[model samples]
Structures are given as C-alpha cells and as structure tokens.
Target: MNFLSQDKSSSRPNKAIIILSLWVFAILLLGFTFRTSLDEMITVWINVEEYSHGFFIPVITVYFLWLRRHELKFIEEFKHSLPGLVIVFIGLILLILGGLATLKTVEQYAFIITLTGMFTIAFGLPGLRVGAIPLLFLIFMVPFPQFILNNLSSKLQLISSWLGVEFIRACNIMVYLEGNVIDLGIYKLQVVDACSGLRYLFPLASLSFLCAYLFKGPFWQKVLIFFSSAPLTIFMNSLRIGIIGIMVDNWGTEMAEGFLHDFEGWIIFLICMGLLFIEMWLFSRLSGRKVAFNELVLIPTEWSGDTKQGNPDIRFNKSVFLLMLLLIGAAIASHNIEGRKDLIPSRKAFLNFPLQLGKWEGRNDYLNQYYLDVLKLTDYVIINYTQPESGNHINFYSAYYQSQREGVSVHSPKSCIPGDGWQITQFGQRDFPDFKVDGNALIINRAIIQKGDSKQLVYYWFQQRGRTITNEYLVKWYLFYDSITMNRTDGSLIRLITSVKAGENIEAADQRLQAFIKDLIPVLPAYLPGKNS
Candidate 1:
C-alpha cells in the first residue's frame, strides 16, 4: 500500500489515453483520405520488398521497446491530456495546409507533424511513453513527395554515375562517359536514376530511425549513421555496376543480361547491410556499451510489487494486434491500386483513324517511332539543327525552327475539322538546346508521320509538360531540340519529335527535314533511337 501510494500513477487523470486515441484516429484519417502520387511511385518497391522485409518494422519496434524497457517500466499509467489534443489539432491544421499547398511540402512536414503529435500525447503518460516508437513507424508508410525524391534521386544519379565511370575506366574498359551514360562500345548503359540505389533510401532510413531510438550512442554518431547512407549506398551500387561491367567484358552479354542482373543487385544489398551491422557493432564497442538484445521483457513478479493494473487489459493488446492487421491491409490495398495495369484499348478502337481529326500530326521534320520493348531504343526523339547567328535573336531562330518541326499547331486540320472535340492538354515552348520558340524568327516545317501497332499512340501525343528556357548554356547552343512521347496501347511509349531547331530559311529546313524523314521513313531499324520495340 505504501509503495503504491508513493507512485504518482493514480493522481494523473488518464488524459494521455484520450490524446493518443485522437492522434491515432487522425493518422488513420490522413492515411485514408490522402491518396498520393509518391505512393504510386513506390509500388514496385512495395511489391518486391513486402514479403522480404515486411517483418522488419515489427521486429525493430519490438527491439526498441526492449531496449527502453528499463526506463519504460516506470512510465505513469495512461492518462488523457486535453492540452495535448489542442497541440495535435494545431499540428493537424498545419499538416492539412501543407498537403494542400504541395505534396512535396506536405511530405517534408509529415514526419514533423507526426513527431509533434506523438510527443504531445506521450508527454504526460508515464507507462505509455513507450508508444512513441510505434507512432513514429507510421511515417515510413507515408509516401514521400516527388520533388524531394526527384532531387535526392538526381543527386544519387550523379554520384553513382561518377563512381561507376571511374571504376569501369580503371578496368581499361573502352568506355566513353556522358553524364549517367556509359558507352561500352556496343551497348550504352545509362545509369538510370532508379539504378542510383535510391531505392535503398527508405529502408536505410527506417533502420536509422530505429537505431536512433533503440541505441544510446552519441547524438552525432546517430546522425552520422543516418546521413552516411546516401554515399554508402551509392558507392556500393557503383561497385556492383563495376563488377558487372568487368564480368560482361570477360564473359559476354548472356551471363550479365538475365539472372546475373538481379543476383548482382541482391549481392550488393547484402554487402551494404553487412557493412551497416559491422559499423553498428564497432560504434557500440567503442562507446563501451553492450548491444541490447533482451531488454524488452515484462517486469519480474518480485519487482512488480502489486503495480499490475487489473490484469493487463486484453482489449489493449487486441487493439494493437488489430491495428497492425489493419495497417497491413491498408498497405496491401495501396499496393494493389498502384500496381494495377492500364487496360489496353482494342486494336480497332485505338486504330480508328478518324477523318474528323480530334488530334492529328502537324508538319514535322524528324520521323516518329513507337515500340514495345523498353530496351530497344532510347524511347526519345532527337532533333538536329544549327543557328548561324549569335545573341537572343539567334536563339529565337533556333527555337522557332525546332518548335515548327516538333509539335502540331492549333490550326484546323485540312483533312477534316472537328467542332472543338480536340483540346490540346499541353502546348508551350520547349527548353531543350535548339527546341525553344521565342519572338519572330526563321523557322522550319516538314511532314509529320505517325505509325504504331494500335494507332491510338498517333493521337495521344506527349509534351515536355513544363520547362522554361532560362539555361545559359542552352542560350549559347547552336541547336535546339527536345522529344515528345504519347502513350501506346501497350504500356510502352510512342516517341515523336517534340521540338527541333531550324535557323535557316523554309527551303533549307524542308531539305533537312526531308532527309531526316527519309532516314526513318516506312520503317526504322530496331537499333535506332526512339525505337523501343
């Protein structure tokens, strides 16, 4: 009775429980209402990693509680905090505003809001403070905004490409480098942003967050481990690519092409993970602290001293289990939606080339090519032209010429006119070197051609979407160019010339355009650029 009286657990109202409930409800609502583009981007990852690493979150959560068990044992009994609810409300408002403003901004703020809300709820709760780890876990399930991901991925691309080039060149492999592309004589390997090992980021981040919570390492050391993942992942992936290049050089394409490709990625991942474990072990040893493995057991009966509150609520445990089940379901549902393949249009429906043109090809110089195989071509159209003059005026001419050859104009199709059935979803100046359009300038025009298996691709033309021509290097370039792509009946893309430059008169533009068109006329070889099939 004396010991129980000494404990402040009974004095505090169970406000923390109410606060936590509200927090959980809010997050559940957010997860429900918010369908995100980032979520879609990670679909492939979810599919591949779900079975393999799906247990990681729970395993880590349990480990964290174990490590903090000693401290958590004394946590006051659950209590509601009305003030905490106000804090959560404020955070909710900010989070909603952020989501509305921009998905990227919202993603950046998401974790912050989560942390604040969780801490606010856990503040007054003694025994319930352990819930923070689980609350924090929700952030991992949220999709990251595209802007942040794109920028991070781009940086990874540069780092991985640079390291890969250096490593491959060291092997005396006759390779030419251009940005992320490696010209390995016969085959060009563009270290696509995905291959930059950016995929490992979320997993590593998850691990780091868990480590930070579970370990008693120096604050700087924890931060260091988290940030080091970027370079560590990039370097390891580069090494993997380098090894693959060497193997391909010695063994030929067959060994490097199929099974080995996947095998190599896994090998690199394991190696990196092994390195992470070693680093953690070394850090713990150096800090004179033992690793915590069995820290989460329930209090001993001797130490329990009648602190048991009416037999651990079966409902509480059941709620946690049910919540976990629901999370798993939610994750699965999100993945299902994300991975759903687009229904292919019927060939006849797609190929009904209407004389009443809703969308039709305008005059263009370069030939458009469509294909089903992703690796057969660059899946992009190239425009080649030169400017004779200098200054903004010359740049304008290059742009105008390219623009004339790139896209269809809004003018009525002479073949047949549609009463506003066709609306160009996107049309504007392109920002590629020779593909910009400015004030009055010399331009070029040539015949536009469209061919695909189903023919819907000929109508659903692609644009750059959005870009501005403020680049200084582009301003100096003699040629302006860019690419346009349309969706194929299949999931592949049908590439068309989005932009091209022609600084010369119409006659010269016509000559070059004809030559370009003839080179790709009737049929293009499979090896040419923009030929995916």
Candidate 2:
C-alpha cells in the first residue's frame, strides 16, 4: 500500500506535464490556424458594445470544464474516432473556403468545429458528450455576420417600440408609436440599435444558457429555461423604455440620453438576471422538488469522491498526431491563399459621373459626417433630379465599395427603409428586356413604401460584375462566388425614390421610375465598374 501511494504521487506530476503539453500544443495550433479570425473577434469585443460579453465567454467555458473535471477523470477509455477525423477534414475545407472568401465568421465557426474534432480524436464520443455544452457555449463568443445583425437589430427596434408605446398607453400617458419612435407629445424617443434589446438579449441569453446547464431539473425544464431568454429580454427592455418615456414626460428629455440612459440599460440587465433566477425557482417548484435557489444554481464547492480508476497506461493516439500534421500543412496553405489581394477593376470615379441625364437635370447632395462614417462607403453619389417641363423630382442614391470582404458592404434598403419609419405596402421585381445595359437586360426591385399619409416609390438593385441582381440572397452568393473566381468583391447599391402624387396611381409612379432607369442605366458603367469597365 505504501509503494502504491508513492507511485501514484510520482505519476501525478507526469500526468500534469502531459496535460499541460497537450494544452500548449492545442493553443499554438489554434493560434496559427485561426490567427486572423481570433484577432478580428477580439477587436469586435473591444469596439462593439453589443459583443462586449464575448470577452467573458471563454473564461466561463474554462470554469465549466473545471467544474466537470472530476466527471471527465472517471472516463479514462481513450479511443481514436474515424468520425472525428472526418469532421476535422470538413472543418479544414470550411477554413480554406473561409480564407478564400475572407469571411471571418466562417473561419471562427470552423475553428470551434476543428477543436471539437480534436476533442473527439483525443477521447472519443464520451469525452465529446461530457464537454458538449461548454464547446457549444463558445459559439456565443463569435460575432454574428453584419447582415444578420442589422436585420435582427431592425426587427427588435420595431417590436420594442410598439410594446413600449402600449405600456405607456396602459399608464394613461399620451404616447404614439411610429415605426421605432415613441411620441410623448413633448418628447419623442427613438429606439435605435443601443436600446433595441440586443444588449440585454445577448448577455441574458448567455446567462440563461449557463443557468439551464447548472439547473438540476428535467430536460424539458432546462430547455424551457434556456428558450425563455428572448421573450424575457424583450419584455424587460420594453418595460425599461416605457419607464424612460414616463420619466421623460414627467421630468425632461435628459432621462433618455447621456449617462442616465446607459445606467438604465445596466440596471435592466441585472433585473433580467434576477428574473432568470426567479424562473429557475418556479421551475424547481414545477418539478415537485423544492430546492433553495443557491443549491439549484450555484457551483459545487467540491466534487463527489466516487471516481473510478481505469487502465494506468495512457498514450497519445496516432490519429491525433496525423491531425496535427494536417493542421500544419493547412496552416501553411491558408497563409499563402489568404495573402492574395482582391482584383480592383479600373474605372472612372463617381466624381466624374455626369449630372445631366438627357431630360433630367441633377443637383448633387452630400451625406453628413455621421452617416459617412456609418456607411463606410468608398465613394457615393446622392443627387436629386428634376424633369424641368413636368416639375417631377426623384432622389437617386448610389453607394460603391472597392472591397466588400470587410464588415462594410451594401446595406439592403429592405432593412434600412423600415428603420427610417417607412412601411412597405408592396414589394416585387420588375424586368426590362427592351432597356439593356452593357448587352444584358435590366431587372430591379420595386417597392411602394409609406410613412403616414405620404407615399414613395422605390427602385433598387445590386450591380456587381455586370450582373443585375434583384435578390439579396443571390447578391451574397455571388459575392462569395465572385470573390473566389474573379478575386473581386466590389459592388454598388443603386436606389431611386420618388413621391407618389396625391391623385396619381401606382402604375404612374412605376412608369416614372422605369423611364428614369432607362436613362440611368446607360451612364452607370462609367461610375459602377463592372466586367466591361
């Protein structure tokens, strides 16, 4: 017995060294493989307030692993998995594609997948099942693509605004809701991105996930706890907005901006966390087991002493070593592949674009510094054109990007128009076979949008590599395809807006836009660089 104890103590240091060596190897490989993606994620965490919680996710994941260390120690059967190797291969493909397309989001997801594959290869299915939640939790750290974020933020803004106005009305306060704005007679509150409930939703969703994982309850109850995060965040945020509206009405507009507004957000987030605890308690009662909140949610101070010993001999799997070799080769290839620069087509700038288009006379317009910064456009042209004889006017806006691989790209009007208090009454595509541009027929997205009594007709399309795309999904697909095949991600968004006359029918507005598009298409090649340009 004395010899066994001494041998166990001596081998413990060897085990620790081996584990530390594996961890170091993992970190070094991941750093080399996902260098760009990791750097971009950290930059986002520092710069973007919505994603600030990202910095804590990995720490919490490590804590979770520590909490489960005893459970993991008991399962000592190490087996190399073919499925894991397949998954690693798939991850490598995704990484290469992500590198080729310059999509950081894809690279980040691929990194997680490859790590999961490594875990599977090291300890087989049992290890993966044990650490599944922690591995999955890493997803919260990845920043969502800009397009998805914009759409989600826009929708949250509208929903929160409506609910907030409803709450204010319940209090007998004279409040009106328009799109994402709350009108309280004296002051109006616009539910912008900051107050769109995202800040609360992301952090609370993460908290709820953690709570669900820690909660000792039925599977269904855990799922319910996790899924309740979205609705709770929306409700609490709406309540906060309503409270702000009441405060603004009674006191002043000062309650809605500056430090107080931010203070309200932090307070509301804490309240959201408290509400999650209340939910867990209620779930506990529903499960027919009355448990203290502390017992139900807190981490255990010490692990159970029921761990079983397994085979003393532990060796690194050959498959894992092979995987490392593959990773090294991929890292080298990806480094070379991503270093290739985008092919920028040579063309005249928007500065040289002609203002006069046949019968239409144009006056240039400029966006403010705030908008310019937000848009991140390489070049843009905003002009109002008038037909002198009929006194008809249309606002033409075009934004061009030299490279759309970065977060800055064309924002769909489908997302932006709604945020600006416009409601779409109708939306569809229009084709013009007779009016051709650069030997290809023209197609555009036509929409009738209204705010209050005023109505406007909008015509827009994505012009990329001489292709006229009406679908936003197609634009994204082509963006990816073109980036790989043609080495160009440059594109432009063209939008034309004209008011519908008081008595004019929709057809008349369509005709006006169609006539303008005919004149505009011929001159577009000079400004919007395409295959021909």
Candidate 3:
C-alpha cells in the first residue's frame, strides 16, 4: 500500500509535466505559426532606442529566471481551465490579426488587437502561475503604439525642456524660451523627443520587473517599485537635459556633440541607478524588513527534487534537450534575419526628371537643398540625416503643434548615425547622384509643390550618387526623394521658398540659392546643421 501511494504521487508529477510542456509547446507553435506582431513592433523599439546595448537585457533575464528557479520548479500543474484555453486562443487570434495587419501595412489599427489579446489572456487566468506567464510577456511594452508613443515622447520633451530652461536660467545664461526650445542669443536649442525621458522606458520597465520578482515583501511593494519608474525616469532624464544645457550654454554646442554626448548618457543612467538603490534602501528601513540587496530565498517544495546531489542527471538526456535548444535558437535567428530583410530597401534605382536631361542622381547638395525647401513649410519638423543608425523616414509637417507648445524651440530629429529618411523619393524616374549642390536659385519641382487655400502638398527628392567634383571630374549618381502633402487648417506656411533645381547645376548651387533666399525671405535664418551649429 505504501509503495502504491508513492508511485501514484510520482505519476501525478510526470503527468503534470507532460501537460505543462504541451501548453508551452502549443503557445510556441501558435506564436510562430499564427505570427504575433511582436517581431516588427519590438524591432521598432530596438531600432529607435539602444535598449539592447551590451548583454544587459539578456543577463537580467537569465538572473531573473535563475532567482525564481526554485519557486518555479514546484509550480503545481496549473488547473486545466478550458475557459482559459479559450481566452488564450482568442489572444492568439488577435495576435495573428495584428501581425497580418502589420504585414498589410496597416499598423495603426493592429496595436488595438494585440493589446486586447494580451490583456484578455492575462485576465482570463487566475493565480500567480496563470498571470505570471502572460505578464512576463509585458516586455512588449517597449513598442508603444504611435499615438501613445507620440504623446509620451512629447511629455518627455516637455520635462527635458523645462529642466533645460531652469538650468540655463540659473546659470544666468541669456536665453529666450518659447516652447521646448531655447534661444540663447547665439544658438537655439530644441529639446526634441530623443533627448526626452522616453529613452529610459524600456530599461525602467525591465528593472522594475526584476526588482518586483526578487523583492521578498508584500505584493504592493513590488507594484510600487514597478510604478515608481515613471517619476524616476522623468526626474533623471530632466537632470541629463539640464546638465547638457549647462554645458551648451557655457562651452558652446561643440562641447556636447559627438561620442562625448553618449558618454553623458551612461553617466546619467548610473546616477539614476544609484538613486533607485537609495530609494530601495529607504523603503526597506521604513518597512522594517532587513531585506538583503541580493536576497533570493530559493526553496524546494512538493514538485522539487533534492538539489544537494544530482541523480547522475538520470544518465543525461542530452540529445532531446540539445535538439530542443537548437530549435529555439533557429526560430530566433530566422525571425531576426527576416526582420533585417524587411528593413532594407527593395529597390536601388536613380530618379529621372521628366523635362530635364540625365537622371537626378543622388547628389548631396541637391538632396539637402531639396529636403530643406520642403521642410520649411511645415510648422513642426522631424529630419533623418542618416539611414543605418536612424530607423524611420518621417517629416512631420505639423509636428510644431506638439513641441512648440511644450516649450521646445530648436528641434532636430537627426542624431549621431545615418539611417532611414536619408534617401530622397525618386517619384517614377530613376538614377540619382552621390552628391549635388544648389546655386543661388533653388529649383523647385513644380509637380511637387501644390497651392491650395486650406491645404498644400509639397514633394521633393534627394540623392547621393556622385563622387567629389571639387577636383574637376564628373560625378556618378542615383535618384531618391521624399514626397509629402501638407494640410493646414491654420493659415500661413512656415517657410517661403524661391526656386529649386530641376536637374544638374553648374557653379556654386548653394551660394546662388542662399543669395536668392536671403534677398527673398530676409526673416529666415541661414541653413545650419543641427549638430554642427
């Protein structure tokens, strides 16, 4: 009777393991086969922010799982709730729809479906075992929807701008504040989105989760730690902006440019971590818990085996485990490769002008001048100077409505690296130069510039297909340009242009255009590179 009881109990555990494995397998199969929008969505976050820098995220994940290993090992075979399975299936469907919608180029609406599914799956199940698995998926929060992201980004900009203004003012720097911009008599600085607190969201979220899981306190304490990230991130990011602002005010913008700028980022992050630790220590004292910093009490229970000694690994089931690991690795690699392929441009051809001879090869001078004119009309602007480093191609015609109100003045979307939005749209034609310049007379593509009472449409192109012509040699070229239509409920355009080059140019293109523009719109400032000037 005793032996039979023991055998029955042991069989139960094995059955539970089989069931759990099946569920995990099912989730994986569904996740891979149905396609969750996670790949593309998460890719955007990883591209925009350097969140995956180093092995920080991986290390954190490993540590977190290791810390919970003992507790996780004894996790009961979760009750087989058919209702929960139904809910998970619904979530799976939503995830599939989101992915399909994304593939169809309908991104805005996909998020709703994905979020609904995630929320349903998390809510439908009960108990720690149930919610824990779904909640672990919250790492997807990094890729916020565009609308939400924009709103959050603007909030971050406002915080950074406010701090920058205060710091500059405290330093007795002569400055005029409008929105998120500062006119320091010499240079105008706009506290744009990138500099905003938005950068810390993913890191803070990850850290908060780790702290929550590790802390041996009430559930509310964990919740509090997770929620504290908002204020913590905002406060630290403000400090970063203020420090940078002070540097800019005292030692010119050059002091805050280049790789040194990134160095400041790390310093700020370290300081933020210090603050977090201090706060945690304070909390522990108040709560009267002698919580150890690295304390993780791992214990075995009913489902756990004796860790004091391994049972010779039961003769080592190596082949099956190796194959399973290999499969997981291959899935991850395939996803990453596919993601990279999706990002690269499908076509590589120069744009040819209809009326003019020779294609508008991507010439630097031409591309710069082309985009400069188009952007002038928009109230708020986002520019991409590089392709590989930068992730998206976007020029906001009315972005000013957000940042300008937030007290940011000098706005620039360009950062350190070159990526997307660098190449100009070629329309239907092909062939662009490596670089081209504009003379006094700026040539505008008539087809692109549309005039309307309430709205306007402006299209332009930029390409870099030519080599250095300074040494007296014709340059090779290709054609690329961006086209955009502007809608203005409010009257008045931001920039008034004179002319744009239709094709190839001789002599100094920029000088000629600059002279013309200076004569034409005296109020407009001379073209200055955001990072340089």
Q: What is the descending lDDT order?
A: 2, 1, 3
Over 9-42, each residue of candidate 3 has an lDDT whose tens digit, in order, gives 8987686566456546634643464343445544
lDDT of 1 by residue, 1-533 (tens): 88787566654435446534654774565465334533432462365442234345545555545544444332123334333444445544444433332223343344345344444444435544555655566466554433244445555665676688789889888876554566677666666655768666667666666655545578877777666666678789888777766676777766457777878887877777666666676777788877644431223333233443433321122233333343345345444533443222222221122222111222213323332131232223322223223211100001111121101111111111111112122222222233322211112221232221111101111211122222222311211222213221122122222222334343443343333333322222221112132
lDDT of each: 0.42, 0.84, 0.41
Better of 1 and 3 by TM-score: 1
For candidate 2, the lDDT comes to 0.84
Ranking by TM-score: 2, 1, 3
Best by lDDT: 2
How do all models score by TM-score? 0.50, 0.92, 0.49
Residue-wise C-alpha lDDT for candidate 2, range 1-533, written one tens digit per residue: 99999999899879767855764686598678888888999999999888999999989988777666655532233344676778788888888888888888888999889888876776677768878999899999999988888889988888888889888988899987767878888987988988889888887888899899888889999999999999999999999999999999989999998999999999999998888999999989988989987787876555332457443344445575677777887798789877899888887888777779889999999999998998898999999999999999999999999898858888889888876567788999988899776678889899899888899999999998888898877888888888888888899999999999999998888888888987888888888888755
Q: Residue 336 of candidate 2: its Cα lDDT?
A: 87
